[model samples]
Target chain A: MQFHTLFSKAVPLLWYGSHVDKCEKLTRAPGGTRLCEASSIVVYKSSLLQILRLVACEVWDHLLHFVTLLTHRIIPCLDVKAGRVVKGVNFLGLRDAGDPVEIARQYDEAGADELVFLDITASHEKRDIVYDMVRKVAEQCFMPFTVGGGIRTIDDVTALVQAGAEKVSINTAAVVTPEIVRQTAQRFGRCATVVNIDPKRVPRDGFEERRAEREKQGLFAPHAVIPDGQPDDIVFEIHVHGGRTPTGIDAIAWAQYIVELGAGEIVLTSMDADGVKTGYDLVITGGVSSAIDVPVVASGGCGSPEHIRQVLTETDADAALAASIFHYGEYSIQETKQYLHEHGVPVRLTH
Target chain B: MIGIIDYGMGNLRSVQKAFESLGSQATILTTPDMIDAQVSHLVLPGVGAFGDGMTHLRDRGWIDPINDFYKSGKPMLGICLGMQLLMDSSEEDAPSRDQPIPGLGMVKGTVMLFAGDAYGPGKLKVPHMGWNSLNIQQDVSLFADAPENPHVYFVHGYYCSPADSNVIIATTDYGSPFCSSLKQDNLWATQFHPEKSQRVGLKMLENFAAC
Candidate 1:
């Protein structure tokens, strides 16, 4: 169910474009085997695209770097409140970070593949974000950046994209008017919109019993991981309005639905792991990622460079979003990327 | 002055800004008349659908001027969709079950989507958004002073498959090594955005502008 109240700005994401044909020739070739199915990497192992192995060291580095960049993104997320970057624990206990424009400049200089700006209080406060801020930030960064929070209508998405946002996110509004996704996709192109799904973990007791029961029932069951002393494996529930409320929607199901609706990507945030920084909710992220044909950006609870490395390596997520870790200078985006590159995750390094 | 055709599509500002950043004056040309004595080079920047872009090029009456500029023996560049428009036709409309849209036919090729949905499990997303290496196929001024296999920014769902592979100056892998940049005489086009690509992109734009 959609939350009736908004305590803070909840992130909504939209992805549209029949490629919006960004470049006349850099076409995102439209045809393809509809949503790849259990394909083999073996197909590419001997292909030219995977020819990094035979090249000389330096060329190999450059080629693999390109591969890493094409497949992964280390996105610096700015959780903006009152037009300033802020960090909150569990979407509460907010701490002032810095001015958005300047911090954005820092991320750009530090080699962020993409930038995400969430007006953390826009939805909770029920106010439209200032397009001027979006415009200012867009001008400051050459890389494509996405903005989320409190966006409810086509005009909201249009205003943000027009103000230089390559992508506009929809969270709470998606629950209220899911069709907004279709309308925005039709108008903006399927690649321009993204659906932000913040799912909270809910208890599913007798997990072993349920896993066995589901297997008997033939539900195409999820992988069961029952930790010691836990009541059963947990299933994630979609949340809206700043993680203040939970919906009946299943996280993986929602991800699949959004992609079918033409949303280009899913920004899957884990409420259970929001600000503790233990790490991302890998189970849900990987599950949702595998369930959808589009890219899934794993958000929430990144405490260190290793955390970014963990989410990316351990999950199928195409990108990872972190706020406080980068904002407070715990790790520069370059450091995070370098760590990833060193650990063999293949991130583009900025000199 | 470098004249950027303002056929009313795509990210035009950044291209102009990129040229400005390189200490060159790039102007957005909306009318064919603006293709004047002051402007030595032309750029066609594009975004949005091919049909709509062609309509804008037609409604704005830029088809003749752009083609004429190509004939003037002066250098011209088409970025992204502007580059694809130089091809003969595109399959971007195929998803709607519509016939392939016709293009300017400047380059011999048919623009089509990657095989399959170009989306889903175990496949690259159609937009193929992000940075990738450009495999330089030939030594052209566009890549002069640029590094070999330079990584450039790309964001597209369809790609131009040139009938004449020789015109393809460079190739970038995304399902396969589709044409990433192509040059024929003074006419240049890139699927990747040189403006957003930082150094390499700026260098290519600068090289084109220098002519």
Candidate 2:
């Protein structure tokens, strides 16, 4: 089957770090019966050293899968805050990297197939896109580039495209006015518009302890995170403004809706995996990729070439986008591609 | 000198830059007076829907001037939505549902939607997004040294199906073989965006510039 057809049935996987232990202990199987099947463990130890070990393990697993098929993309995302390339240190605070142009050049030379420049500060100001940054990056960058942040109207998209940006990504504005996607796609072309979905796993009802703990502590409890409110109900909720607001809509349903609304591609960024430098939340990537027919670009927690290999193998993503690892010069594009090739994954070689 | 007709569509800057990238001078002309004064190659680029775009051109009384410029027989090119407006009519109109809005009529075709097994049954995904290979149907100066089956960027849902298939110089597959480009004498139009399309797209623009 063609890749697009397979993508239609792709299932998104949401990573709940070790919540299985809590579920098994908290709720006794009815009459102490073996109610639930043996738990599937998906754990990510956030320690720097442990992450490195996990990276090695994941690479080995990916290498086995790569021998069978050739697909997957390594994408680098540049988060722009206040007109500078900024990455959230552990998804907490932002650090500036001076000019976007210089940083984009580095990524381009480093071998990023596609680049996403997200204006992280646009929603706060409620302004249109700053074309100057777009123009600067577009001037030097030679790869397919997607620019998000502060895209409010057709004019904003037109300005970005005119300034040399290939695709205009919309998130907040898309939520506020869903028709904006269709309108922009109608005017600019569907391929020119990309819908960026930042989703977070929310506690389902019936999972009361997890809800209570989350409410009181003002933090996510990893163990009780999967909402058990609805039986056999695994719901992924869509969040806007960098996972700051819950839209009360199912992430899978939203992904299908945006695609119907003429979105050329879907950029799925796992809020849980973002900036963690552990790995992509395979569960979410798989779930969303399976739901939408358009190409899915997996975003968030990509730390190594092994991480890139695992994402393409485990998830249905057409491409995997990372920031910190590539930006910090931990790996070069040629090195990653060569690694993928050696591992049996099909990747475009630089001529 | 390439004359870029600027009728409020948003792609003038990028198109001009593409021409400049190829070492060609492109002048964006918005007024009929300017187009009349400058008798050179003409490029009509647009970014919005067909009906509104035509309305703006008519509102500014550009139809007559544009027709006059076309009669001059200098090379003329239309990009993306501009290419769509070159048709005799389009099905994309809402307010003027039954009305047949006039296009440049340089090519004898009407804008229509993609049909058959490619798009499947349901809501059509307009604005066929992303990079797709262009199947060059004929030898034309517009392509110049560009590679065959070169991937060009596309962003529109509706495409121009010329009444005369012989005019279609290039075609691309997106659910179906839609006319990606058309050329008649000195008149040329591309459904794909050359400015946004990287090397190959620029090459096409450079061909236009050199022509």
Residue-pair clashes per prediction, in order, are 47, 20
C-alpha TM-scores of all predictions: 0.78, 0.70
The residue-level lDDT of candidate 1 at B19 comes to 86
Per-residue lDDT of candidate 1, residues A1-351 (tens digit): 013111111111011111122221222234433233233222222232223322233343333233333646878777777676766322212232356777665666677777888877644344444577777776555666788887878887887776767678888888777788988776666667788999877775533454455457654345443322234547566778899875555677667777777687789899988889999987788677756656788998889888877787556677898877766667777778777765556555632
Kindly report which residue stretches of model 1 are placed more than 4 angstroms away from their true locations once superposed: A1-71, A88-97, A121-129, A204-233, B95-98, B116-121
Predicted candidate 2 versus true structure: per-residue lDDT over A238-278, tens digit per residue: 78766887655556667878888888788998888988989
Task: Give all candidates' CA lDDT scores.
Answer: 0.71, 0.68
Docking class of 1: incorrect
